[model samples]
Target: MKVGVKDLWAGGILIFLALLGLFINGGLLGIGLESHALGTARRMGPGYMPMLVFWLQLGLGCLVVFNAFSNGPDPLERWTKLDLTTLAISVSSGVILWRVMEAIGLNNNYIQVGAPCFVAMAVLAISPAWRPLGLVLASFAIFGLLLEPLGLILALVGLCVVSALADRDHNPVSVIGMTVSLCIICWFVFIYELDIRVPLWPTIF
Candidate 1:
């Protein structure tokens, strides 16, 4: 008994995504550059949130490329080997979160609603296996915890944890090394320069 190659289409998509991510994250999104102060917060326009998002997306894309490449994708096949369970969970969770958004008044309190969505997305990325899923969820929970109520430190710690989990081995030394490096880089762009108002924890409204 053996596995024929997975669909060539998926493999090609994976590779194409990698290249797209690499270029966008490294250059287009300006990951390594500095940004000007946002200037205003009330009357109209240019919010810290958008800059925060740009940085996050840049980071995601870069990390995605790393993930796609490190997996050493299998050869392409005509037939597709779909992971329907994972896809189903992700899509369902996303749609449900969006629907619940209006009920929860997420439009007004974006942070509260967004925190759970972030956690769900991360958790669903893993299969239903508890050991792995629990670990991932725990990290995300800590992130949301820190990102609410107060300061930047806890969120930073959570960020470090989540970033480390992205790797397969979760080797402590390497994870720590990578985490610290990414944190410093992010801090330089988002904190020192852009000065985005990231909550350490969310205050209840």
Candidate 2:
């Protein structure tokens, strides 16, 4: 079977990622994870996630190569240049927001700084018809900002509401129900089951 350029390109990228992951996990050149650091599976060490990711990448790359050989060649889609203006605006806005947050002594979390900029860029760059992305970004930004101050439940609810706005055919009742249910489940799983350290409610509330 004839191989397509698209398949080859994808396969090459996957293979490169797989090798890079492996290199990082294998501690080659004395720069990657050390053997001693990779503890048992039950008590996962620093290298566990990297090893898992690399192995998955390797497997996917192999599958892509096999599919390329098994399938016949097809027409490649035309590649379009990325909108540099959108990228520039998004990056600059994110940087500015981060700096402002730092100056204001708001928690310097990366998500809190980046989310608003992402929403702004999405709203400005994309067609107005697809405003849901902007809504989602805004929701995420709000969630990030409120997560610590308002606590998880309130922040998550706010996230759900704003993100639900992205769907043109959204049902408010369903969105609220789902958001509440998800927040409860997340609170239970992350806080109780996983024993994660996060505030359930604000100190003032």
Candidate 3:
């Protein structure tokens, strides 16, 4: 079967993600797995999650390639000037943000989060379908900003609420109920079960 641009693009992206995951897992990103304390059960290795994710990505990429060869050609979607502009803006913004964050310091979580959210919102503001993604990014940025001062529960609640807003069909009551339930579950898993040192409630709360 003839390969189409969409297939090529999809395959390339999956392969890229797989490689990036491997790079991260291999400790080429400067944060080695050796730095993390290994639990008695060997479940706490720093590379464990990265390795799993990368392997999954690699598997999916292989599947994509196999499908590309086995299936019929896909129709190519034409990109308009607006699409090109959006792509350019998104890519440039991400690149610039990465460089700036690296030059300054990655320790600044606010900048790390805010820059990408700004880029997403700015680039996709014209598209209604993409507004949900923008909203999710914005919510994550806010979560990162509030994580320290507001504490984990509050930050999580804020994230859930704002992210839920992304879905136009979402009901506020259900959103709130789910958020509270999730917060409780997180508290039990991360705090009570794992005994992580982070605060559950805000200082003022």
**Per-prediction TM-score, please?**
0.48, 0.54, 0.63
Clashing pairs in 3: none
Model 3: per-residue Cα lDDT over 80-161, one tens digit each: 6666676577667767776778778774566675766666555654455456766787677777767778899998988897
lDDT, model 1: 0.55
Q: Write the per-residue lDDT of candidate 1 for residues 22-78, one digit (tens) a residue.
A: 444343344423343444443213434444455465555555545545454555523
Give me the candidate number with maximum TM-score. Answer: 3
Steric collisions counted per model? 9, 1, 0
Model 1 alpha-carbon miss at residue 162, Å: 2.0
Weakest lDDT window of 10 consecutive positions for candidate 3: 33-42
lDDT of each residue in 38-118, candidate 2, tens digit only:
665555566765777777887888788778875758556642334445455556776777677777776656665655565
In candidate 3, stretches whose alpha carbon ends up further than 4 angstroms from where it belongs are 1-15, 27-77, 93-110, 117-122
For model 3 the local lDDT of residue 95 reads: 71
Sort order, TM-score high to low: 3, 2, 1
Local distance difference test, each candidate: 0.55, 0.70, 0.70
Q: After superposition, how far is residue 23 of candidate 1 from its true place, in Å?
A: 18
Worst 10 residues of 1 by lDDT: 1-10
